[model samples]
Target chain A: MTKNILIAGFGGQGVLFTGKFIAYGALIEGKELSWLPSYGPEMRGGTCNCSVIVSDEPVGSPIVNEPDVLIAMNRPSLDKFEDAVVPGGDIYIDSSLVDREVRRTDVNVHYIPATRLSTERGFDGIANMILLGSVIKGSGVIKEETIPAAMSKVVSAKRQNLFDFNIRALALGAEVLE
Target chain B: MAEKVLMKGNEAIAEAAIAAGCRHYFGYPITPQTEIAAYMAKRMPKIGGVFLQAESEVSAVNMVIGAASAGVRVMTSSSSPGISLKSEGLSYMAGCDLPALIVNVQRGGPGLGGIQPSQSDYFQATRGGGHGDYHMLVLAPNSVQEMAQLTIQGFALAEKYRMPCMLLADGTMGQMMEPVELPDSAPEMAEKPWALTGTGLSRKHNIINSLSLTPDELERWNIDRYARYAKVEADEVMYEEYLTEDADVCVVGYGIAARVARNAVNAARAKGIKAGMFRPITLWPFPKAALNKLATTCRAFISVELSMGQLIEDVELAIRCSRPVTLCNRTGGMIPSPEQVLASIEEAAAKLN
Candidate 1:
């Protein structure tokens, strides 16, 4: 099985970091994966996106032109990459940050109030992880059990204190799907 | 076997250079390649090594020349424009027959082009980047794993040939992350008897210079360097042939473009078209003999590239025009999708049928 994932948000929104979490989760499961970030001037407060490919076979072409799963945390990201999703694919949107509705009806769209939910749940800045949890639950691109191991690898030792908050945010986001 | 770790291609190159015993690094920061310098900056001091950020690419390459003259493993990295600035120093290093590794993580071309992935520097790299009759061993890596592996190999090859080597990668390879298994043991360093180490009263001092006044002497030096280059061409031509044994349409590409072609080849095969890929690992040597052999069986060839049509010229020459060659490419930092390449493959297949 192979999943081509695109995660997009503002520069400081942990867009690349959330993609890294998924990439590491794929690696820990012994799957072939490639992660590529959009490293242009957009990285400075503009829209930044990352492409992550997890596959049973070796990943070819790290650039994802068509995504099977897209996590768009802001309105511009959703408006930009909405039509690129394949039919029957999944798109998880941060409802608090993106006010517009997804225009496409062919793909499954899950709207989570990630930014507000994280704020209410005491983890105000980790809306990216909340969408990651929703993506994992809705798409099964990765096993939820692997998130802890993946988080430990991605979040450095200096920020180990935020580990519990990230976990709680993930749980809260996953609960939204039920 | 060592445990695998997921690392960006730039970071993997730095770690592998460290593992290969390259302790001295001098470089200028550039887009899509600054991660290598950042990584070296963080790790070098901890390991009692030198990682100097020079004032400019020119100064950085000169520093590389100095470090190489001392017979130490050294490296410098930059993007396209920065590499152009270092061309003069590159010529001097080649003329002096110094061993070092230079990485060009290429971006869009011309003057101050956009900071995006590009393979437009193929001519500049394979034709000798500076004003000299010399060739650097240019290794093109498609994956992050090969980014690590080739850095280690590039150092070894440079030392063996007593000439500079280059890792001709692009922005995509520098930015992507993949699982890589770096070697644990340090690579064996070769003895440099010709290094410019000051000798005591017991022996003669060694001098490193590229200047030769006499035309006859310079002629002989050029001849000698070409002889070594010929030996390298004969021995170090590396390539990969996938599904070409029974293919009617052959696609030629290197680096990230080759990865895109791989997917296209698979899709073409699924459509009952006999398509395959020939990826040159060493871009300088051009893998001429292997490509010539494939030309006999494969009726048509498509040169897939991230440039207008640079590699197509090499493909045509390598096959001696024996097969019909076509160009399937994108330029100015844009990459051709698999669907586009598959369409090209279908066109080649239709003509052959």
Candidate 2:
């Protein structure tokens, strides 16, 4: 099975990091994958996005035009990419920042209130991970147990102290879905 | 021992060059390819290798010429505009028969274009970006793994034929990250008998020069170089074919566009359109024989590229126009999606009727 994912938000919202977390998870699971960033002037304090593919077979195109899953962390991202979701696909939105409702009736829309949940839980600045947790639980795209090992690979030594907080964010995000 | 790690294409190419015994690197910073220079900057010093950021692309290429003339493996990397600045030095390298590696992680073209992915430099890379009848051995890598493997191969081929070799990549290939298992170590390089090592009365002093003023002597020199080029053309053509056995339509592309075209081919096959793909790995020695052979079996062809129509021209010449050929392209730093390529394939298949 192939999972085409598009993660979008503002530059400082950890949009690219969310995609990298999933890409690393897929890599740890021994799956073929690719992570391509929308890299240019837009990456500097502006809207940014990345396309990630996790597949059993070799990934063909890393640019996801019609993604199977769209993770929108802000209002602009949700409005911009909602219609591009494949029919019967899933769209995960952060309800705390994006007050707008998804107009697409053909897909499953999950609003996680990621920002409020993360802030209340004392794990601020990691709303992306909470949304990622919800996607993991709702979509089951990767094994839940594999994420910690993947996180170890992604987080550098200088930021090692934040590993525990990130793990909690993932758990809290998954709990919202439960 | 070889280990599997996730690496971006530009960083992988830099690491691979270091492992390939490339100790001297000279380049100016450019987008989509700056990671290569950055990596060399961080690691080259630890290994006692020479890494110099020249004042400009012109100076960088000339520095490579100087290093390569000293009989050591050397390299330089830049994006589209920077590469144009190095064109004059490239001609000098070819004329002097110097062995060096030049990497062009191409961005959009025609005078300071955007820093997005593009393959518009196909003509410049394959047809000798400089002047006076020369061909650089050009290798186009599609994936991150190939980014490393092909850099190693580029160095080997450059030394083997006493010519400059180009690793032609694009912004997409330079930025994407994937799992790659690198080689255990750099391969052993061959000895350079024509190197300008200072003669201490042990051997004849060697001279590396491109200024053959006499027309007759320059003509003879050009003939000798063409003979070597002919040998490389006969020997080093690399490509990949997917599902072309009984297909009526063949999709041709290279680098990232080929990856996109493969997905389109698979989609067309699901619709029973009988489509396949032919990807050229070596752009200069350009797998013309394989394309010519496939032209006999396929009914139509679609050339998918990120440029307006650079590679399609080569496709037309390769098949000798025996079959109908069409182009599906996006330029100015835009990449064509699979759906767009699939529509082109359907159109090309419909033309068969």
Candidate 3:
């Protein structure tokens, strides 16, 4: 089976890093993966995204037309990619801020309060990672334990303390569905 | 290389330059590429390399040209407007046959357009933005690894032909990060004996000037320059051909757009559409021969670019051997999606069949 994932949101929302964690996790898991980012001026204060394709065979392409797993961290991201999820694919939205609801029978939609959960867990500005937890829990694309390891590696070496909160946030989001 | 460190593209180029034996760098900082200047600023002094953040891009290029003329491996870089400012210096470098590397991390253009990644500089780069009949050996790199590799090759080729070599990168290739395995350092490679470091009292003073008083001498100089360009065209042209063996359609592109086009070609093949991609790594002295050979089997060609059909002109000229080359592009801070390219290829293919 092939899985395509797109993590997109505004510039500082950590959307790029969110996708990085997933891609790196998949790579570390010995899965064939490709990660590509949205280039140009769109990278600053604009919507930034990275598309990842993971397959058992060599990935035919890295670009994704219809992502199997979509993680939307903001309203614009939710509105833009809500319809892009492939039929029977799943989606994880930041329920804390996204007010609108999506109805699609073929795709399973999970509304998780990523921001609130992150805030409650003392992980501010990490709503993207919180949203990542929701997607992983919903999709089981990677082992829950490996996600934290990936997060720690991405957190800037200077901000080593920040990994504490991101790990806590991921665990909180994982337990919420249980 | 360097013990397997994670680095951004800009930093990688700086490291690659040093590894390539470049001890001289002069540039000013611009957004999306500031890290390159920053990397040089920190690393150059420690390694005994000369790093100068010039007053402006114009000053930077001239400094590089001067140092390079003195037989030093020198370089300078900037974005769109900055590169535009360096045109005068580039023309001088080409005219004087100075060996150097000039990097243009392309951003939007036509007047400080924007800080977005754009391949719109194809004309400026390949057609000689400066006022001259000379061409800079343009190398387009699609990935971070290629960015480093090409920078080193750019310096080497510059010395080989005694001409200015350009690294035509965009903001995407500059700011993006990826794992890169760097090649061996410069000393490991062969050395140049033509360097003007010193001629000694045994011989007359060496003068590296573009000016010639005699009309006949100047005419002969231009002819000599073209001869070198012809040799470059024959020896240095490089490209990548993928899945074009039995393909009915050929998609031509380079740099980031080329990477995207490759993915789209794979996607089209999965959908039962016979598609292939020809990515020209060298823009000037373009890999025309390769494309011409591939044209024998392909019925039609698709020109994929990020500009308004800039490289399309070149592809049409190259593939004039057999088929028509259609264009698929997105301009002014836009990147054409792979699906869009596939649709264009399919549409163009439908016309012939």
Candidate 4:
């Protein structure tokens, strides 16, 4: 099965990082994947997005026109990409940042107050991972157990101290979904 | 097999170049391709290689010419505008018959254009961007793995033919991430007998130059270079054919466009449209013979690209216009989605019916 995922948010929102984590998770599972981010001038303190395609077969187009899953981290992102999700697809919204309700009735909408949840849990600035946890639980796109190894690859050697904290945040988000 | 690691395309190119024995890197930073320079900057010093960030693209290409003249593997990378600036040095390198790897991770074109990925530089790369009659061995990679593999191949082919070889990729290929297992062992470097090494009074002194005062000698040099290019054309043409046999329509594309077209091909097959894909791995040698052969069987062709219609012209010429070749493209940094390409293929198929 192929899953086309689109992650969107403002700069500094870990939009690209969130996509990378999912890509790494898929890679660890020995699945074929491609992760393409929206680069260039618009990324300078503006909106940023990433398109990640994870598949059992070799991936074809890296650009996701119609996403099977959309993770919107801000109001602008939710408004911009809400309609692009396929029918009966999934949309994960960070409700703390995006106050607007999704108007579409065709897709599955899961609203998690990711930013507020991250702050209340004393793990601020990790709302992306929290949302990712919910995404894994809701969509089952990747194995939840793969998050630790995937995080280890992406978190970098110098920032190893944040490893456990990130794991905690991911688990909390997953539990919130349950 | 070596362990596979997920890496961005630009980073993969830089790492593969190092593994392939490239020790000198000189370049000016450009968007979508700056990661290569950044990677080289971080790794070169530690590995005892030289990485110089030249003040401008012109200076950087000149530095590449200098390093290559010393019989060492050298490389320089840039985007569209920077490539235009390096054209002068490129022509000089070709004239001097210097072998080096020049990477153009192309962005939108005509001018500085934009930082988004584009294949508009197809004409510029395959036709030899600089002035005069010359051609660089151009390799177009579709995936991040090919981005690494082709960089290695580019260096070897450049040295084998005594000319510059260009890895003509787009910003998409530079920025995308995929799992790539790079080569474990270093590549075999060719002997450069024409290098400008100091004579120890045991061998004749070699001159590395492009300027010949006599018109006849300059003409002779041009002719000789063309002869060598013919040999490369005969030996180095590379392309990929997908589902072309027993098909009525052939889709041709290179680099990222080919990847997009492949998805369209599969969709077309599901709709029973009898469509296939022909991807040119080498833009200069162009796989003309293979495309021409496919034209004999396929009823029509669609040239999918990120440029207005640059690749379509080549598709027509390759098949000698025996079949109707249509352009399915987007320009100015915008890429055609798989749906757009599929629509074109369907239209072509309808016309045939």
TM-score for candidate 2: 0.98
Q: Alpha carbon lDDT of residue B138, candidate 2? A: 95
Tens digits of per-residue lDDT, candidate 4, A1-178, equal 9999999999988999999999999999999999999997775459999999999999999999899999999999988999899999999999999988999999999999999999898988899989988998898888988888898998876787798888888888888874
Q: Enumerate the candidates' DockQ scores in order.
A: 0.89, 0.84, 0.30, 0.90
Model 2 C-alpha lDDT per residue in residues B1-353, reported as the tens digit of each score? 48678899999999999989899999999998999999999999999999999999999999999999999999999999999999999999999999999999999988999999999999999999999899999999999999999999999999999999999999999999999888878877878989988898998889999997899999999999999999998999999999999989999999999999999999999999999999999999989999999999998999999998889999999999999999999999999989899999999888887
Tell me the whole-model lDDT of each prediction, alpha carbons only. 0.93, 0.93, 0.81, 0.93
Residue runs of model 4 more than 4 Å from their true location after superposition = A43-45, A157-160
Pairs that clash in candidate 2: none
DockQ for candidate 2: 0.84
Q: Indicate the docking level reached by candidate 2.
A: high
Error of 4 at B307 (Å): 1.1
lDDT of 3 by residue, A6-121 (tens): 88778888877877777767756767665667765575568888787777765543556689998877788878888888898877888887888876778888888888877787
Off by over 4 Å in 1: A157-160
Q: Is the docking of candidate 1 incorrect, acceptable, medium or high quality?
A: high
lDDT of 3 by residue, B80-159 (tens): 88889999999999888888888888887679788877899999999888996799999998877788999999988888
Instruction: List the candidates ranked by DockQ, beginning with the highest.
Output: 4, 1, 2, 3
- How high is the lDDT of residue B225 in model 3? 90
Q: Please give the lDDT score at residue A135 for candidate 1.
A: 85
